[model samples]
Target chain A: MTTEDTPNHRTRVAAERRGKTRAKLLESALLVFAQKGAGAVIDDVIAHAGMARGSFYNYFRTNEELLAAVADEINDELLRAIDPVVLRCDDPAERIACGTRLLLHTVRRFPLYGGFMARLPFPAANSGLLGARFLARDVRLGVATRRFADIGWRVGADMLVGVMLSAACSTAREPLSPAYPDASARAMLRALGLDEVEAARLTALPLPAFELPPSSLLRRAQLLSVGRD
Target chain B: MTTEDTPNHRTRVAAERRGKTRAKLLESALLVFAQKGAGAVIDDVIAHAGMARGSFYNYFRTNEELLAAVADEINDELLRAIDPVVLRCDDPAERIACGTRLLLHTVRRFPLYGGFMARLPFPAANSGLLGARFLARDVRLGVATRRFADIGWRVGADMLVGVMLSAACSTAREPLSPAYPDASARAMLRALGLDEVEAARLTALPLPAFELPPSSLLRRAQLLSVGRD
Candidate 1:
C-alpha cells in the first residue's frame, strides 16, 4: 500500500503535462484556421502547431475533431468577449447601441475573425451574422427600459444583425468612416422606436473599449502560417 | 458583284438561326447554374439547353466562359427586373422602401435566383448586392423630399444591403412571414429618420405586386438539373 501511494503522485503529474500539450495543440489549430479559411489542409494545422504529425494523430483522432474544436472555441470566446458590457450594462439602450457598435468595430479591427465570420461557410452562416444568440436579449432589455418603441424585439434584432454584417464586410476592405459608428448606431436606435434627439445622444455616448482575444493567436498566424503570409 | 449581293440574303438568314441557338443555350446555362451552383458540369448545361455536346462548344469556348456569362446575366436580369418599379416611381421614399421590400419578398418567393444570389462566389459579390447604381439615387430622392433625416445615403444603403442579404438567406429555406415585408419596411423607414406614423402608413399601404422573371428558367431547372432534386 505504501509503495502504491507514491505512484499516484507521479501519474497525476504526467496527466497534467499531457492536458497542457492538448490545449496548446488546439490553440495552434485555431490560429491556422483563422489565417486560412475552413477548407485548410490538416497537415498545415499540425505544422502550424509546431507539433510532429504523429503527435497530432495522438491527440485528435481525425482532422474533423480539430476543426470542430477550433470553431466551437472561436464562437464561444467571441460571444464571451461581449458579455461584460452587453449583459452587465445598466442602461438597456446602451446595451443595444454600444454592444452593436463594439461588435461591428471589433470585427473590422480583427479582420481574420470578423471577415471569416461575415463569410462563415458553416450551415449556420446566416445565424453567424444575425447575432441570434445575443440580439433578442439586447432588444428585450431596451423594451423593459422603455427605451425602444413597443415593437417585436425580433424585428429590431434582425435589422441590427443585417447592419452588422454589412459593416463588417466593408470593414474588411477599409477602415470604417469615422462617422459610421455614430450614424449606424443612431439609425438602428431610431428604427427601434427612440426619438431622434435621444437616439443621436445615446449613439454618441462615449463607447467603452473592449479587450480583444489574446495577441498570441495573431502573432502565431503572422509568424508561422506559410501560404497566408 | 450582283451575284454576291443575291447570296447575301441567304447567308443573313443562316446567321439569324445560329444567333437564336446561342441565345437559347445561354438561357439554359443560367437555369442549370442557378440550380447546381458554380460547380455545375458542362454536360448539364448542354442537356438543359436541349443541345448536343458539339452545339454547346459552338456557342461557348469552355465551361468557364458559360458560367461567367450565366452569372452576369442572372445579376443583370435581376437588376432589370427591379427597374420598372424603382426607376419610374415618382416618390423617392416609395422607390426606396417598395423596391427594397419587393426585392426581399421576391427573393424569398423565388428560391433559385435568390439563393444563388445570396451565395454568389464572384469577385464582384459585394457589388453584386450593393445595388450601388440604384441605392444612391433613392437616397437622394428621399433627402430631396425632406422625407429622410439629412444624412449620408451611403449609410442607409449599406444598412439596406445587409438586410437584403439576411432576408434572402432566410427565404431560401422557409417561407417568409407575410408580416415581414411591412414590418421590415417600417423599421428601415424609421431608421432612415421618418416619423412613426408616416413610417407605419407607408409600410401599411397595399404593397404593389412584383413580377418575377419568366418561368422558363424554373421549368428547365426542374426537368434538367440533376442531384439538386
Candidate 2:
C-alpha cells in the first residue's frame, strides 16, 4: 500500500472528518437556538444540520448538553477574539469599556449570535462562561487598582453585564443607533463609580480594530445563517 | 321560565364563564412560557391548561397573541399595585427608585411570574407595555425636572429598564441578597446622573408596602404555580 494508505493516515483522516461533523453540528445548533430559544429539541437541531438522529446522538445526548457545548464554543471564540485588545489596555476602566463595546459590535455584526444571546435567560447567558471569566477578571483588576469603587466584583460585574446584555438583547431585535454601545459602556462605567467626564472619555476613545478569524463562531454563525436561509 | 333561566341571566352567566376560561388559559400560558421560553407552542399551553385544542383557539389564536395578552394583564396589575405608592412620592428620583424596588419585589414574591419574565427577550420584556407607560412617565418627569441627566427619555428608560429587567431575570433563578434590589436601584440612579449619596438615600427610604390585590396576576400566578405542582 502507498504511504497515504497507511493506518496512521487513515486514523488521522477519520478523526479530521469527525471533528468537521462536530463543528457542523455546533453551527447548526447555534442557528436553531437562535431561532427557537432554549426550547429547541434534538429533532430541530438534526433537521437543521441535515443529519440523522443517530449522528446527532453521537455528538450530544440532550438539548441541555448541546446548549452547554454551544455556550463553551461561544466563550472560547469570544475570548480569542477579544483577548488581544483587552490585554493591551493598561487601565482596567478602559478594558471594561473596550470589552463592552467589542461585545456589542460583535453581536451587531452577527445577528444570529445576538439572537441566540437575546433568547438566553440571564443566568444561562452569564453563568460560568461568558461573564464568569473575562468580565470577572477585569472587574477584579479594576477593584485592586482603585480604578473602580470598592463595590465587590459581583455587584460591579452585575452592573456592567446587566446593561450590556440588555443592550445586546435590544440589538438583536432591530438596528440600534451606532452610539448605543458607547452610551451603554459609559453608563456601566458611571455605575461603577467613574465620574461622568472620565466615563465619557473612556467610552469615546477610539476602539481598536476588532478581528475575528474565519474560524471563529461569529464567522461560522454568519455563514450558517446564510446557508440555512 | 324561572328567573334564573331568563335570557339576560343566561347571557351574564355565559360571559362570566368565558372570562374564567380565558383567565385560566392565560395562567397556563404563563406557566408554559416560564418553562419553555417564548418558543412554547399552542399544544404545550393547552396541555398545561388540561384543555382541549378547541378551547385554546377560542381564547388565543397564536402563541404571540397569548403572550401579548399575558403582558397586558401583567402591566395592568403592576400599574395598579404601584401607582398608589408611586404617586405618593413626588420626587422623580424617588419614583424611579421606588419603581425599581417594587418590580424586583413583585418578581421575587411570585417566581412563576419571574420565570415567565426571565424567559422573555429584552424587547419582548420591555416594549410597549412594561417600560412603555409607567417607567416612561417617571423618566420623562425626571428628565423634565432635571432630576435625571438630560439624556433623552429613550436612553434614560433604557438604563432603568435594562438594570431592572436584568436584576429581575437574576432574581427569577435564585434568591439574591436582600440588598440586591436596592443596590441595583442605586446603580441605576448613578447611571442616570444622581450622586452616590443621594442615590443611596433614595433607595434606602423605607419602601411603602407593596400590595397586589387578591385578584391580581401575581396572586393568580402564585396559585397557579401551586396548582401545577
Residue ranges of candidate 2 with Cα displaced over 4 Å: A28-68, A87-91, A128-132, A140-147, A150-153, A206-209, A223-229, B28-71, B83-91, B121-123, B128-133, B140-146, B150-155, B223-229
Docking class of 1: acceptable
Worst 10 residues of 1 chain A by lDDT: A121-130
Residue-wise lDDT of candidate 1 within B1-229, one digit each (tens)? 5654677876987798997786677667656665565456789878877788987887788765665565565556657767676776787777777777777666655566545544443123445562334666787778767878876676787787777666655555555677776777788888889889988877776666666555434334434444346
Task: Report residue A12 deviation for candidate 1 (angstroms).
Answer: 10
Cα misplacement distance, residue A54 of candidate 1 (Å)? 9.4
Best by TM-score: 2
In Å, residue B56's CA in model 2 sits off its true spot by: 4.7
Cα lDDT computed for each candidate against the true fold = 0.65, 0.76
Model 1 residue runs over 4 Å out of place are A1-73, A90-92, A117-119, A122-124, A130-132, A140-147, A150-154, A215-229, B1-71, B121-125, B130-133, B140-147, B206-209, B215-229
A1-229, model 2: which lDDT tens digit per residue?
A: 9989999999999999999998888888888888886457789989988899998888888776777687778878787778778889888889888988888777667778767777665556666444325777888898898888766666666666666666656666776677667777777787788888999899988999888888876688788688768
In model 2, what are the clashing residue pairs, if there are any?
none
How much is the lDDT of residue A29 in candidate 1?
A: 65
